[model samples]
Target chain A: MKTDEKTRAPVARIPDADVPGTVERMRKGERRAIASVITELERLSAAAPALLRSLQPHLGHALVVGFTGPPGAGKSTLVNAIIAQLRQQGRTVGVIAVDPSSPVSGGAILGDRIRMTAALDDDGVFVRSLASRGYLGGLSPAAVRIIDALDGAGYDVVLLETVGTGQNEIDVAEVADIRVVIAAPGLGDDIQAMKSGLLEIADVIVVNKADRPGAEQTLQQLVGALSIRATMSDKVPVLKTSAINGEGVPKLIETLDQLGGKVRAEDAVSRRRRRARYLIARAASDIVANRIKAGSKGGLDTLADSVLSGTMSPHAAATRLLED
Target chain B: MKTDEKTRAPVARIPDADVPGTVERMRKGERRAIASVITELERLSAAAPALLRSLQPHLGHALVVGFTGPPGAGKSTLVNAIIAQLRQQGRTVGVIAVDPSSPVSGGAILGDRIRMTAALDDDGVFVRSLASRGYLGGLSPAAVRIIDALDGAGYDVVLLETVGTGQNEIDVAEVADIRVVIAAPGLGDDIQAMKSGLLEIADVIVVNKADRPGAEQTLQQLVGALSIRATMSDKVPVLKTSAINGEGVPKLIETLDQLGGKVRAEDAVSRRRRRARYLIARAASDIVANRIKAGSKGGLDTLADSVLSGTMSPHAAATRLLED
Candidate 1:
């Protein structure tokens, strides 16, 4: 997975049989082959199911970690530091930056992803930006499939980065075996985003930009918040990291390694199964939404009318729609 | 609706017959009654369908306007200015602040909503906050129901304010008759959020905090951004508003009035129907997610096994599950 000599090659369409070949190369750690599989998934091509099927034997081999926080928390820098440390340890890392691109604040995350990817020249680290705009539900289709690609490509670790406390991010982040939430010193408003919900999902909380003033206060605040939680407090660790100077990163990586060590053979099977369930449910939701929105079906408009008139509960109407 | 003498009353449980009475009082613009209906909806009570059904005849009279932007855009302040002007024009207003509560930034929007509501002493204005956390989809059931309650209560206008660019906010915002997206001067990253997608949906773009430095540059930048968009550029009007001094608010109100005028009775009918579809779809999605997550059904595991092994696609499995 080193520097590609084919950097200047023109694109050529792969025959159906060779699509499976690309998947094989992807499994053997060829960067271009992995990228090709990802491109097919992003295109929502007919080859996706076949590719994923081809990836089945190789699934759940890598440790998947999720990192999330509000903007200005230095999430990108922190992720970079983690990548550097992982590379030094002779581990290949795959990065998926889930862009929570809502209509109002759409492209901001894209810039961060570009910058993060550009800074990493090592072939062992592959980073891709997943635009989550226009998606009506949690984690996009490409995200789940791409994770499989990276994992199947024999990467030692996969890093998922999202820069917001959004429902989309939460759904995406939950897929990871480890979830890391980061905050910078003195970004109190950023912490507020964490207090109600994000803190609940965090496995490891990092006070990024620890060189800044109030880093201790931020770290203490996170600890205090985690302590009040009934379940995750004792399990979750809070660390301080100045990503700019690489201070405190080794401990963070060590924590990650310890946490990564906890995932056993059985847990991987369950994780793969959970991902399957997510894919199926998301597909079902889309199917239901499309059928309801189209109103071209005979009975849907009547059900909607029943709902509008308050004669039927939405839950009941949905039950009928699904069961009938 | 003004000056409730019954504010100190104990929380009394309403009988089933009397629950309908509260809905009637809500339709007649009684503040306590409206609050009661909203509370019931929030509780996801058994009486919600009947309350909503009782509200059907009163739907679609009020002009619905949505305002959204990044945090720190002075959304609360601008909304307050709009409320004051709306009250001065003898228009009763209902405000629904859609809080895009993600795990990390959960309670911040709640604080903004509380402050906005506290400042409004007029009985003619009502504001409610709806949390959009822990949801896997866009918008929430309570938010949709609350809009009906306010609309049915004879408010002349309903204002929706969302604190961020999240999918939940986007869905909630789309329910408005006229969508207004706000921005402030020199928040370059904030504007980056808009440039990708929010500018396209904006019916009226307001550069709030016009008193801030570089307001003109911001205005020109937005105008240039709008110019590049083929459809919305001609229709969308970018205006500057010094929400602190109420500068440009009257014009903003005038713009709202003009835009609100274009939504005819037929459009209102279609809009209500769309809301019904959203409700049904959400309910269906919830049902699907629950069922898939439970793994309780007999055949689901088999289907999931096929998916895990890549023998079948997610969409195909969903189709078989639904259609079977």
Candidate 2:
């Protein structure tokens, strides 16, 4: 049961009995079994294959919304407000809060865990905190798989929280149905308008901490930026919310409702399919890379020497290794 | 020259010019075309494929070192110090600083560029700041390609300065021969030392800004943590340095020298191959996923409606989408 002892130890695979039956039952709408299996998977990469198999069915059903912004932008608070409102409408929610863990200790600071104190006790709400674990896009490949697992587990909504401000956090755009980019006042006007590659991915932008001094200014600045980029069809909606005082929480909920409909109805399914295929491509690349790396450990040094001596170029040498 | 302007633009293959006809000449032990082609590519990525192809005979040779840590951890300063030490010993160094651009602005803060001031004016020192655009790893997929470009260009030592701290940043361990994870004192001893996936990948641990009050204590804490996970082959060396004052820089450089050799001689080839393979897989996945998504825009909504209407289970829907 406790499989993670040594690095070289062969990782355990999900039992065949559990795997096939779980997949079948999950397809037939078994929730508790799927959720239990998913929890066990949190400890290790084991159970991932079975989980992935089970997740195959829910690929496009649940709406995935990603929330990201600078720290102290009231993201967690806003998420809580959104969760509460969604639950009121009888929606089952799956929440993943990605907290930064100790690089050396692997223990989570659990910042969001502590903050989402309200969601912990709600049975309708399943809040799981995942360590960023140095994942670039603020999430991991495994995280993408897990999102699928949650979607399969019958949750009506899945919310992914990412480390804010850092640029690598944009990987969220690849996986989510709706992206809520949060920002606050005093962060500069240049920060308001999202640009070509980064902020352009946001479906909805929320200026949190609306009670702050420059909230209106931030809002006005954002509107100005959007005017230049907003095509008649691609207009990004900006909303103001005080997650602390609960201002605009209802409006935020209403906005989410609209976005959800937009994503699932006209042209949204095609968009998500493209994202999913990309995820698959990314996974394939990771697998091949891991294999080639595992095979070439012995020859790297001599290659380096030959390279440093000007006897070979790094590109040529790299190509050789790939060929080998 | 400028590709991917339209979201659906085809992925263009780099011409053989990306790599100079270095392999052909290198087989004859000649250098005629290699230098000229690589020199042209130093200005940008468009010229990479041609240079890469031409240098195919000489790659997988350079000792690629990756430097990463939290912001303000003195990574740039340490990088400068490392380069100076290497150059004094007559090593030609190529430095790549991975700076994720503001998605909205398509621009980088260029902070790391300022720190490598010492190398800026040196012809032997090739310093580049890369935006972690599109790729999750701190370095771009194009980054490895660029490193190949540099390797063919004749730089002996390639150093990667990853500007990300999350999991995507952890992708550096896949590409570098030696990974130097830098940390500052007083951030949180347990937090820094306990990072789950990030700290485990370090070949060398650096505690920069060691002049602070708790610097010594921080070093002690780090050493203690490393001891628990330490292996006979991997006793990650921890160094204390003040990049600003240059104290302990020499020791750090010496450690890098020792470790770089170890990685290059024994495992260098496989490591680079693995990195290349991984990039290929990711690229492939990106292409596939993008196309699938473009084709399946409203599939999720239709599925969601089916599930909500009790026509199908969530699991069933997901499986169908993935399979399709």
Which 10-residue span in candidate 1 chain A carries the lowest summed lDDT?
A1-10
In order, the interface RMSDs are 5.2, 8.8
State residue B242's C-alpha deviation in candidate 1, in Å. Answer: 4.3
TM-score of 1: 0.79
lDDT of 2 by residue, B1-324 (tens): 445354222233434343334445533423344344334344333444444445666676778888876544667778888887778888877777665543423343454344436344566676665556522333455566667766756678899876533333565666777888887776442234233334556788889989887888777867766666657225688889988888898898788878877776775446656565555434433343344445555765675444333233334555566556
Every candidate's lDDT? 0.72, 0.60
Clashing pairs in 1: A103-B198, A105-B193, A193-B104, A193-B105, A193-B106, A194-B104, A194-B105, A197-B103, A198-B103, A198-B104
What TM-score, over all chains together, does every model reach? 0.79, 0.62
